[model samples]
Target: MQELTTLKLIERISTLLRAEQRKKYSALGLQPVHIQTLDYLASCNRFSDTPAAVTDYLGLTKGTVSQTLQVLERKGYLEKQQDAADKRSVHLKILAPGQKLLKSITPFDVFIKAEQAIANKQFDSITAALYEALVALQNVNGTSSFGQCKNCITFSEENDHYYCLLMQQPLDQADIEKICREFISVTNSGLV
Candidate 1:
């Protein structure tokens, strides 16, 4: 038997997931982009919740992301909060309604069932392989990894507390778990 190319495997999985997402979100007057935006906002760290970050993450034009954000805000899916320290920068906060909608539409059950069907060792192996592939692509594309803070090179644990050496700031549990735009994976050593 022959192995499928990485691109083929990734694309096929993406197409299937996208089709399901489109079907699930369409009933709620949401496009895949909208659902995608909500999902990103839900998982991103505070520093990565801005519209500019969203634009970068989605690889969409600023205008397009801005419009999508405005629509979500107007429809009660999210809110734009002015940054306390930066007068010009804004943060996108996913509201309760958005969370509810996302929960209702997400096919978590499908993923749970899939996970249950797979052997534990096989699941772990597949996850590791996929992560390596993702990191490789991100490196080749020169894109931000958006990895969890705990997995970043800048992440430091002192005693019982967490700190970000890059930002010279303390990090909470929530901060360590969420995706950070400035994440530099620990695997990429020899950096400042």
Candidate 2:
């Protein structure tokens, strides 16, 4: 059987999910990436690091990250500070309003509502089974196992699980421990 390329799958999913995200978050004048970025900052152990730190962690270009930061800052979602160790570097912290926004219409909540509606409307066991098949394929590709929860895009220390904000899936600690190059120190909730 021919393989379904990763790019093909990602393209298809992104096309659908992006539209959904726009319909929801666009009301708040936010793009899906904006939500992703804010949520990423809120969940970070040390978001008060240089902008380069965020770009590197997200595998995004510095220019793109800088542009997004500007938009976020203008919207009153973030505040920046000069790095103490490096005067030239700037760090970011999500403002209280930003944190509240993230905690409210989270991607997880969206997925749960959609999933519940789909389960209620039709025979969707096939869709569920196909997702299982996709997982099998991912495992075969040697890219499916959890490794490093701390570096995951959806990991939340408050929840203590690798919760994917995009997929809304909860990955076990062992499953995410392997892919955590961007791991930072875990901060207590009281600190925030």
Candidate 3:
């Protein structure tokens, strides 16, 4: 038998994970894209809470994202609000029901068991390796990084205050942890 290449292993793992997700989604009468949009909204910062960002992150068409958003909104999973600054733009906000649904559907047992099995250092190493692989793939595809605001080159901390130079806005602790679509890699800002 041939040895599995890195890409093959990753693809197999992804397929298994998606299969698990599909089961949970089907039980709740939700599609994979619906769950993905909810998950993204839950993690993304204010700057990345728009349909355009969702479309970019999911690599889906505007029409598809629009329909998904409409369904989620109609189902009381999310709300679409006109941006205060940009009246023409809208922001997607996951509601409490969406949060509850996400919590119920999240696959935590596998991750919990994996964490319990791996040493802290080993887990950290694995995380770093996976992040590197994701970066490589994103670079190849010219896709948005959607990295944590705290990890971006534009992030700064001073006197207990967090700020994003790129956005020219102050960030709270929660905001700092949320993912940003405009994330500039701290290690590869020049390349970005």
Candidate 4:
């Protein structure tokens, strides 16, 4: 039998996880894209909560994302607020119901079992390896890293304040932990 490559293994794991996610969310009457949008909104900062960012992150058409957002809003899963500074832009905020739905639909049983089955060090190593692999793939595809602000090359902490050099904006702790569509991977930066 041919041995599985690392890429093949990663693909298999992704497929399995997605299958589990589908099974879990199907019971809640949500499709994968809807749940993915909710998950993204839950983890994204204010700067990344716009429909354009969602479209870019999901690699979906504007119409598709618009429909998804409408459905989510109608279901009371999210709300759209007009940006105070730019009426043309709108922000998507996941509601309490969406948060509750996310909590209920998280497919962590398999991952939890895998963690329990592996040593802490082994799990850490595996996670790091997977992250490295993901980075490589993203680089190859020239795709957005969608990493947390703290992991971006432009992130800085000075005078007890967090800031993003790229966006030229101050970041709070919450923003630092949230994902950004414009994230430039620090690992890919030219720093040793």
Candidate 5:
């Protein structure tokens, strides 16, 4: 019963954190989805140097990823080039403008603002407790064949954290193995 209650609280906190990111990212001309795509592209060292590597890492539906790539390309945030080794394939590379933008934007600012709503240093305690609960849950979920964030379609680096744009949640290694449909890998590279 105690564990159940803690899980419930974590769920609620997750929802609130998501809503906060939505509101903040929206203002930057990005929805969580856009951030996810960008985040994935930036994470892999290869993709960091060759943007087109994003498609391979993400395993996205070709058409959907292509469309998203076009949007980013058109926006001048990414550059596309034909692969030298495989002329039939294209490579996407993050441009100077894109890096500049990502460096300037982060949803953590919202987290800090929300933290102010609590009193007496309670926020830290709550956050720490929640993390502990999540770790406990992970132990139960982690014994599977796959880790969530590592294998997820939407897991991506965002502002120093692994974010899932589809579920609007952070990706945990354990959660990915559960094959949860709500989560996907995300990116934080297009923010600034």
Candidate 6:
């Protein structure tokens, strides 16, 4: 019998994950795209929360993002606030309802079995390997990694204060944990 390629195994896993998410979304009367948008909003930093950023990250058209955002706003899941520093730019902030909904919908039920079955050491190793592979793919594709601020090339920690040279701003704990659209790989930046 022929062995399965690594790509096939990865695709199968992704398929199952999406199938499970679809089931959940169906039951909750939600579209996968809407839930996905909400999820991204929940995990993304301020720098990545605008409609333009969402469109870029989701690889969707501006009109599509605009329409979906309108639906989400009508559903009271999020709010659009004009940027204080930039009037032309708007920010999307997930409200309490969206946060609560995401909490209930997430934890990705499809991974429960695998997550429970994996040994801690093996899990860590696999996670690290997958992340490395993802980074390589993103590099080849010329796409932003959308990684945590702490992992970005411009991130700097000085005397317990976190700062981003690219943004010219200080980062709080939340900002450091949230994904940033401007993220650049530390190694790729030739700084490490």
Each model's backbone clash number: 0, 11, 0, 0, 14, 0
Error of 5 at 93 (Å): 0.9
Candidate 5 weakest ten by summed lDDT: 183-192
Model 1 lDDT at residue 9 = 41
Candidate 1 lDDT by residue in tens digits, 1-192: 012345644664465457556767777787889988999999999999999999999999999998899889989999999999989999999999999988887664444444443324332345455554545444543556667788888989989899999999999999988778898874444352
Best by TM-score: 4
Tens-digit per-residue lDDT, 70-136, candidate 3? 9999999999999998899999999999999999877645444444433343323444545555454
lDDT of 4 by residue, 14-117 (tens): 75567667777778788899999999999999999999999999999999999999999999999999999999989999999999998876756656555443
Model 2 lDDT, residue 137, Cα: 36
Reference-based lDDT, each prediction: 0.75, 0.59, 0.76, 0.77, 0.55, 0.75
Model 5 C-alpha lDDT per residue in residues 70-139, reported as the tens digit of each score: 7788878788778788787666677887777677666455445444433233323555555443333333
Give TM-scores for every candidate, taking all chains together and pairing residue i with residue i.
Answer: 0.58, 0.53, 0.58, 0.60, 0.50, 0.59
How many clashes show up in model 6? 0
Which sections of candidate 1 miss by over 4 Å? 120-192
Which candidate number has the best lDDT?
4
Higher-TM-score candidate of 5 and 6:
6
Positional deviation of residue 9's Cα in model 2 after best superposition, in angstroms: 5.0
